[model samples]
Target: MLTVMGATGNTGKKVVELLLAAGQQVRALGRSEPRLGALAAQGAEVLAGDPGDAAFLTRAFRGASAVYVMLPADRESPDYHEAQRAKGEAIIQALRESGVRHVVALSSLGADQPEGTGLLVTLHAQEERLKALENTNILLLRPASFFENFLDALPIIQHQGINADAVEPDHAIPMIASRDIAEVAARALVQRDWSGIVVRELLGQRDLSYREATRIFGARLGRPELDYVQLPPEEMRQAMVQAGMSETFAGLYVQMTQAFNEDRVQPRAGRTADNTTPTRFEDFVAGLALDSANP
Candidate 1:
């Protein structure tokens, strides 16, 4: 049996679906019962519990040959990194006790760097903890900025014909679709032949500057003149706060943008190859158009 944490999330849902379609027995864990009901109906054994709860994780990992692990960040926590570390410790303890042979961890690019990568420090910590497990094969999936992240900018793009951020307009950053990340995760999970820790970096197609991305998005939206704007850090923070993020969380997000803009949050060469996954930005946006038209 394969256990999937964060089963209600974007990548997790795809992973669970792929595993189920392959006739693999899936145990899906999430915090929301209503959200997990769909997966349960789809023939997954759904468990509702907090990921950081040790007893809960132990129960979830029971009888599973391999598990997919991901930690959802708690921006409202007073000490976010500490919370993440504590959660990591719990997951490691459970894995050691449960005799699970393989672990597929959802980490981020730049997770190998010890410093300067603000929120990503938690991912690095988790990777470190996982490495200490003896006889357990671990696959670290380090994906770049998700194209689905731009869904938050959709309202602004549709109304104002602009895509804006705190990062410099000319700076090129790697981006990948979440579907691609799921595809890689599913492949790794189903093929349990590999042992030891394997790191995979999912960089979609190529790196593109925000300006170039704006032009591409504009072309798809039928607004060829759509523009990209770079806001100051404080302005970006305030915008996030006004959009319903806590002040502390908003500030952290601005700091993350600073790190990205300075090129500090990039990954070194790991096990990256040609991933045969579909759903590029244009294709994703085209689906969005269809959804909007049908809705």
Candidate 2:
């Protein structure tokens, strides 16, 4: 059986669906009863528990041939780094105790550095902790910043007809769709081809700047003159905090944007066929626009 953590999340739910369609036994883990029941209805064994609980996770991991480990993003956490560390340590213990042989950890780009990569610092530590698993083979999927992140801007766009973020507008950043990340992760979980610890950077089709992206989104949404605004880091942080993000995570997010603009946080590896995932922003935005129009 394959156990999937964060099964109620975007990528994790896709992972469960893919595994189930492949006729694999899937155990989906999450804390929400409604979501878990939905997965149960979809042919997965649902285990509802806190992923940060070592004992619960150990039980969930037991007898699994492979496990997808995704540490869900917590914008409201009082201490995001400590939360990441605590969850990482718990998963490590669960992996060790359950002897789960294969793991696919959902990591991000710039996870190799000890500092400077704001939100990714904890991911670096998690990678190290997973590497210490002597008997387990692990795959670290370090995907680029997600395109789904852009959805947060939709409301702002509707209100102001502008796309605003801390990300540098002129910088051609590597952005990927969550579906592509889920596809690669599912393939890795199914194939189980690698041994030891492996890191794969999942860069979407090509690099795209927010300037280029805003134009495309504008065109798609019938707003040809929509503008991309790169808010000042402090302004962005304040906006996010006012929008319900904890001040701590908002600061970390601003730091990450600073790192991005400074070129500190980037993929250390070049793009390869296996690492370059399909799903261009244009195609993704087309679907997103259609969904929004219908909904």
TM-score of each: 0.90, 0.95
- Give the per-residue lDDT digits (tens) of candidate 2, residues 1-295: 9999999887999899999999999999999878688789989999998889999999999999999997787999989998888889999999999999999999999888889878888888999999988989999999988888777777888887799988888998889999999998898899999999999988988999988988888877788788999999999999989989988899999999898999887888777787788899999988874554421
Query: Model 1, 1-295: lDDT tens per residue?
Result: 9999999997999899999999999999999889999999999999999999888999999899889998787766666777788889889989988889999999998888876676787888899999999999999998888877766777767666678789899998777788889888888888886789888777876676888877877776677788999999998888877776667667767877888988887767632456323566777666664346221
Separate clash counts for every candidate: 0, 0
Model 1's TM-score against the true structure: 0.90
Give lDDT per model, in order. Answer: 0.82, 0.89
lDDT winner among the candidates? 2
Runs with alpha carbons beyond 4 Å of true place in candidate 1: 155-161, 218-224, 270-272, 275-278, 289-295
Model 2 quality (TM-score): 0.95
In the predicted model 1, the residue pairs found to clash are none
